[model samples]
Target: MLNLLSGLIGLVTLILMIPAVLPLLGALNWILVPIALFGAFIGLMSSKKSGQYFCLIVAGFGALRLFLGGGIV
Candidate 1:
């Protein structure tokens, strides 16, 4: 159940990330990273590892984007 919810959250966050990747819109990652982390936390509560890993990857991507953008675009 928690894993399912986490996966869903990750999917939503991934979709949102598309727009955040735009040159001047990297600032959106500020909001996305936390949401991805929240999903990862939820996934951590599940018995399986897939959802947790997926969320973590999403969070990582968001963090990388932020870093590359110098925290903002």
Candidate 2:
């Protein structure tokens, strides 16, 4: 349950981090990206096979946005 919670949070963070429509979201996302990654990582490590896969998707997308969303630093 906690794993799912974290994974979902990561997914939300990923959504918020997307800069395609909202520039302000992009600002907060830069700070939240690492936190989201950590949440996803924790979820991944603690989850079952299925949950792990979900977390992987969250982490992967978060990372993708982190680089492409202008949050690399």
User: Which prediction has the highest TM-score against the true structure?
Assistant: 1
User: lDDT of all the models against the reference?
Assistant: 0.94, 0.60
Q: Give the number of colliding residue pairs in candidate 1.
A: 0
TM-score of each: 0.97, 0.51
lDDT of 2 by residue, 1-73 (tens): 7677776766676576566225435455456656666676666666454544565565566556556666643
| Over 4 Å off, model 2 | 19-25, 49-56, 69-73
lDDT by residue (1-73, candidate 1, tens digit) is 9999999999999999999999999999999999999999999999996888898999999999999999999
Q: Which segments of candidate 1 are over 4 A away from where they belong?
A: none
Least lDDT summed over 10 consecutive residues: which range in candidate 1?
A: 48-57
Q: After superposition, how far is residue 56 of candidate 2 from its true place, in Å?
A: 4.4
Candidate number of the best lDDT? 1
